[model samples]
Structure formats: C-alpha cells, structure tokens
Target: MSKIRKKKIKKTNILLGFICVLLAILLGFILVTSYKSEQKESRHLSEIADDQQSGIEDYEAVKERAKELEEISSEEAEDTEDIKSKNTEDTEKTDTAETEDADKTEDTKDTKDETAAAASGIVCWGDDLINGEESNTYSYMAVLQKLLTDNGYNMTVINKTLQGGGTLSMMKMAGVSDETIQGYITRHQQAANGAQLNVTETGIRDLTEEQTTRNDMDCIPVIFMGYYGGWNHDPAELADQQEQILNTFQNKNQFIVVGTRPMDGSVTSEALDQVLSQKWGEHYISLADVTAQPSSTYEAQQAMAEAILQKLQELNYISKN
Candidate 1:
C-alpha cells in the first residue's frame, strides 16, 4: 500500500460523509414546510364551513319575514273590500229613501191643489131645510155649512119660502094658487140667477112661469127637492121634465124628487125611488122614503149633504187625505 493512495481514500470518505449530511438536512426542512401548509389549509376550510352555516340561518329568517308580510297584506285587502261593499249598500238605501220622500211630497202638493179648487166655489140646495123656524130647518142649514167648510167647499144655500114660515108644500097652502106658485118659482129662479148665488134650486117647478124661468137660467146648475102635486095627472110632462133635467144638467146638476107623502100605508116610495134610480144611476140617486120630519131642518140637510159627499168621494173627486 502506498501512502498517497491511503490519504486520497480518507479524503474521499470525508467528502462523501459531508454530502450525506447536507441531503438529510434538506429533507427535514421540506417535511416541516409541507406539514405547516396542510394545517393552514384545514383552518381555512373550517372558516368557510362557519360562513355557510351563518348564510343558511340568514336565508331562513328572510323566508319567515316574507310570509308575515304576505299575511298582513291579505288581511288589509280583505278589510278594504268589506268596507267598500258596506258603503255601496248604504248608498243604495239612502237613494231609495230619498226617492220615496220626494214622491210623497209630490202627492201631498197635488192634494193641496185639489182642496183649494174645491174650496173656491160650490153650490148646495135643500127644500124645507132652509125655510121655517118651526122645525129643524135653521139648525140643519148650520150643520150643512159646517160640513161644507170641513170638506174644503165654500157654498151658499138658497131657500124659497113665503113670508110666513111654511113646509115644502107651501104652494098648496090655504091662500095659495097656481098663479102664486108660478110667481114663487119665478122669484126663486131670479134669486138663483143672481151672481152671488152659486145656483142651486129646491122644490118642483111645474108652473109655466117656472118652466120659462128655469129655461132662462139654463146655464145655472139646479137641484129639485119635491114632486109636483099635478105630476100624477100628467105622466108625460112629469117624464119629460125628469128627462130634461137629468139630460140637461148631467154631471153639472143634481135632482132629488120626493114623492107624495105616505098617508097610512096608501103611498109607496117605490115609484119615486125607481124614477130617481133610472135618472141618476145607482151611484148618484139615493132613494130614501123619509120618515116623519126630522126633529130639526138642520138634520135633514146634513143627511142630504152627507149622501152627496159620499157619492163625490166614491167618484174620487176628493182624496183620502
């Protein structure tokens, strides 16, 4: 063995040893760096998981709020609908009430107008009703006037009686004659024609003068209260007068003819009732066989007026109000 070769071998061994040490140190450093990087990655992943959980909680809270808002909105809409429906119904009811009130007011006004017309001018007539103080005559006139006023009719009553208070049969009184009857009828006709008179006549006008006077005042309305004593003897004239008076006056005048008094059941009022019924029809002619004279003249007139007023009411000439 050579000394130079031995020394070279030792140097090579030392160099090899240094190289192995360097390699071991490098491997150790690399391992430590890799471990540190892996730990940091694990921490970052945990942070991300926490953030995701928080996000899920926030999303759930938002869903609950949205549901609450929807419920509140639905309730508000329902309340508004109900209020509108009630308002509409109230408006309709108010309109209907207003319309009914207006109609009632109009009807009231119309009734007032009719009453005013009726009150302005009206005429009424009765025979024994206006004449004597001996019976209920004056009292009956007062009652008739009161009734006329209440019914909205202003009326004037005319009576034809001699100076002496007498019954409706005054024409046949002891001192009276046909000429006197004619004069009486003429005077009555003239009185009725007067402007102040509303034109109503009582008692039969059978005399020639009476006929002429009645014809002269043809424009005036009349009412005949009693039958003529000569009417039974002259059926033709009686019928002619009946037809003339009925046809002439028509809706304008009224005639009520009382037949001869029933003396001990000898006379029946049927004949007079039939004639009147045929002349005025069922609605206008009221047939009544008057019993003994009323206690007063006022009662008789009231009864006659009542009958006429009832007829007028049936005809709708006056309203219920």
Candidate 2:
C-alpha cells in the first residue's frame, strides 16, 4: 500500500494508547483519594467511641464515690445518736440516786426524832370530848401526837379519857379514883348500856404501882371534863375533882386544864372557868364562852389540840431545826 497512509495509522494508534494511559492514571488517583478519605473517617469514629467509653467509666466512678460518702454519713449519724442516748441515761441515773439519798436522810432524821418522843410523853384526860366517841381518827390526843411530832416537838401522847360522859369514870381511867371498870360497866348497863369502857382498859385498873413506868419528870397532864362532871354544876365541886385528877400525876403544878361553859354559861361554868384559869395560869385553856355541846365536837377537839400545840411551842418543847 501507500507509505504515508501507514504512517498516519501508526500515529493514531499512539495517540489512542496515550489517552488510555491518562484515563487509567486518573481512575487510580480517584480510587486512592477515596480509600484515604474512608480511612480518615474510621479513625475519627474510633476516637469518638473511646471518648464516650471514658465518660461512662467516669460516671460509674462518681456514683461509687457518692455511695461511699452516704455510707460514711450513716455511720456517723448512728454514733452521734448513741452518744446522746448514753449521756441522757447517765443524767437520769444520777438524778434518781440523788433523790433517793435525800429521802433516806430525811427518814433517818425522822426516826431519830420519833425515838426521842418515845421517852417523854403527855397524858390527856376528858369526857367524850377528847376520846374515841366521834372517831379515834379525830381523837385530839392522837392528833396532838402527830402535830407535836410534825412541829419537831417529838412528844408522845397517852389518852386516859372515857368514851362515856362521866367525870368519875374518866378519873377512874386516869387512876385518880378508886372506882372499878366493872362498876362503870355495870353503871353503863343501868343507864341503857351507855358506853364502852373496855376500849380504854389499858389506861388503868387498881393502880398505885402502875405509875412506875410514868412520872411527872417525863410527862405532862391535860384535862377537860364538863359534860357529866357533876349534876349540881358547882365550881367548887369541879375544882375538887380537878385537884384529885391533878394529884394523880406527880406534876400537879405543870398540868393543863381546859374549862368550857356547861348549860350554855350558867354562873357555875363561868366561875369554874375563872377558878381554873386563875389556879393554872399559863397552863389553863379557857372556853367559857363555848357551849359544852360545841366543845364536844370533832372541830372543837382539833382547836383544842392546836391550842395545846401553841402552849407547847411557847414552852420551847420543839426544836427549830
């Protein structure tokens, strides 16, 4: 064939080969750039995953620390409560012990004072006015004993009064008369079984030797007899009876006599009260304006006891401490 035609064909073939080579190089460059970009995205995702894991771990660690703090606080609170409770218990125990000690001390002092009272005493005598006629709980002698001891007097009281309204009967109980208890009982029976003499039988019997346990040196005598002391209501007769009763005790001068108006103040009762007040002086408690019935009441007995307590206080029979 022609030489020029063959040369032109070869040039075309070379140009096509060069174009194919250029296209292959461009495709390789694009593939390599895509692969590098994919690798960079994977590295970024890995870094983000690592950061999230660290954050989760930090949150768990913080929760554990908070739980530890809560446990420590609970233990501290329990310890504080225990200490407070122990302190309160100790205080209560100390207070109770102190109160008990005070009570024991008071009891000891009272026992000592009571022992002193047992040695020295006061003896009382009257009709139903001072006896167990109303109620032994309201007995002036019993009440007086309590009052004396309460006021630090420490004085015991003995009652020799008759429940029945008979001055001779009371004198017999006081061992100031020779009248027998059986005789009194028999007389009571004759008077429609008047009163019980047996209740005060321990007071006396046939007794000059009965005075061995008691004497004027340790005892004081008190008397109030008006209801049936004498049917005639004579002041001289009452005075004679008073002398006899006073003589029964060894200390006749240190006796207390309470005189009250009988029959609502006849001249006899006034004269008797005046005579007793003059004779006994400071030892006499006069109730000349008070009626016999009023003097026999329980309230009157309490008043009489209060007056006796006053006189005893004036005589300095009680302790100040």
Candidate 3:
C-alpha cells in the first residue's frame, strides 16, 4: 500500500458519514409536522359535533313553547264560547219576564173595566126638588142623570115623587089607601102593623107598614119633608112620625134626606131639618149648602144637580174620575 492510496480512502469515508446525518434530520422534521396537522383536524370535528347538539336542543325547546301557546289559545276560545252562551240565556230570560209582566198588566186592566161596567142601579125618590115641575126640562135629577151618562157610567134611575105631600101622602101615592092605614092602626093599637099598614104624618102612628113597602121596592129612597107642617099634627107627634119614617129604611137601604126650601123662615122647618140631618148622618143633603138660591132657575137647578152628584161620588155610589 502506498501512502497516496490510503489518503483517498479516508476522504471517501468522511463524505458518506456527512450525507447520512442530513437525511435523518429531514425525516424527523416531516414526521413532527404531520402529527401536529392530525391533532388540529380532530379538535375541529369535536367542535362541529358540539354545535350540532346545541342546535337540536334549541329546536326542541322552541317546539315545546309553541305547544304551550297552542294550549293557551284553545282555552281562550272555550272561555269565549261560554260567555256567549250565558249572554244568550240571560237575554231569553229577560224577554220572558217582560212578556209575563205585560200579560199581568193587560189582565188587570180587563178586570177593572169589567168591574166598572157592572155598577148600574140607582133610584131617585123625593118631592118637587127631585121630580121638578111637570114642564121643567132641566130638572136636577135629569141633569144628574145626564152627567152620569156622559161620564161613561152604566146607570138606571127610577124616579118616585110626590109634589105637595109629606110621608102620609107619599104612602097614598105608593098604593096604600087611607082606610088600609087606619085598619093597621086599629089592629095594632098604636103600634103600626108592618103587613097591614103603609103610612106616616099626622104623627099619630108608627110607619112600620110604610117601611115594609119601601123595602119591597128594593130601591133607594130620598125623602123630602117640611112642606105641609106635618099635616096639622102636634110638633111632638110630627117628630115621632119623622123618626119612625126614618127608622123604616134605616138599615134596609141607603136613603137620602134633603133639606126643605125655607118655608117663611119657620123655626119648625129649621128644627125638622136639623133632626133629619142628625138622623140621616152622611145621607143628608142640603141644597142651601150647595147654592144659596132656591132651585127655581135652570142654573140654580144645575148647580144643585152637580152638588148631589158629587155627594154620590163621595158616598161611593159612583166612581170619582
């Protein structure tokens, strides 16, 4: 071996060692870069999965909320229906009540009308004050009848009158003869028989017989005395006769007693008038109290008629307006 050949082999060995070190460094660098890239990709996939789960949860929550709102809407709709049904029932009940009230009012009116129509009986019994002169067209009684008719009353009036007489003459007019009256007094011996006698005045006898006849008539009587001075009898006897006449129809029928026209300003007339009024109570009517004038003129007669009608209304013999 020569020295020059040994030196060339050493140089070749050093070159091979240098090339191997460079290749190893390059391979390690490449392996490190690949591992870092794979780790980053795994982390990105995990983040994507988390985001998807969150979205699913949010969607389920929204769906539940929507179901609750639907239930609330359904409940509100049912409440509205209930309110409408209750309103309809209330309206029906109100209408029914109104109809019933109308029916009752109509029935009451009908009953009142029938009751008004049923009052129809009246009688006027008196002397010239009620009967008037035979020629007089506007008699007080006639005027009263006209007024009652005009005011829509169904009334029937029967007039019984004696022009110039007291109780005894009135009995004669009612079909009782003087002999029949005497027979009654004779049979009863000062106590007048109710069946056999019909009488008053002369003051000698009771008037039970005359009263029986009036009751048979079934009518209201209006008696007017003080015209003939009790047919020439004693004042005490006349007073007794007057009392008996009044007692005859006291409770049997509602009768009227009229004050006489002032006859020469006699005290007996005044006394008789007072006694009659005291006995008759509210049934007594005084023409002087109504109008100070005698009922000779048409106007005075009409005024008296109006007063009498008003008294009748007060007595409930007729309706007052």
Best by lDDT: 2
Q: How far in Å is the alpha carbon of 22 misplaced in model 1?
A: 99
Q: Tens digits of per-residue lDDT for model 1 on 1-321?
A: 899999999999999999889888888888898889888988898899899988889888898899999999999999999898889888988988999999997786666456434432322222343444543435433554556568765454333322322222333321234564455445555655753421112353333443223221221222333332223222233333434433433233333333332222323456555555565553434325333344224555456556555554554444433
Candidate 3 — worst ten consecutive residues by lDDT sum? 196-205
Global lDDT of each candidate: 0.47, 0.64, 0.58
TM-scores of the candidates are 0.36, 0.46, 0.45
Query: Which lDDT tens digits does candidate 3 get at residues 136-201?
Result: 557766776788788775565555554545655554445455774455345443443344332233
User: Which has the greatest TM-score?
Assistant: 2
The residue ranges of model 3 lying beyond 4 angstroms of the native Cα positions read 1-120, 129-136, 174-216, 231-253, 261-265, 268-270, 319-321
> What is the overall TM-score of model 2 with all chains considered together?
0.46
Model 2, global lDDT? 0.64
Per model, state how many residue pairs clash: 6, 0, 0
Candidate 1 structure, TM-score to reference: 0.36
Task: Please estimate how well model 1 matches the true structure, expressed as its whole-model Cα lDDT.
Answer: 0.47
| Tens-digit per-residue lDDT, 203-248, candidate 2 | 3333344433335434677777766534234565566667767776
> Which of 1 and 2 is ahead in lDDT?
2
Model 3 per-residue lDDT at 15:
78
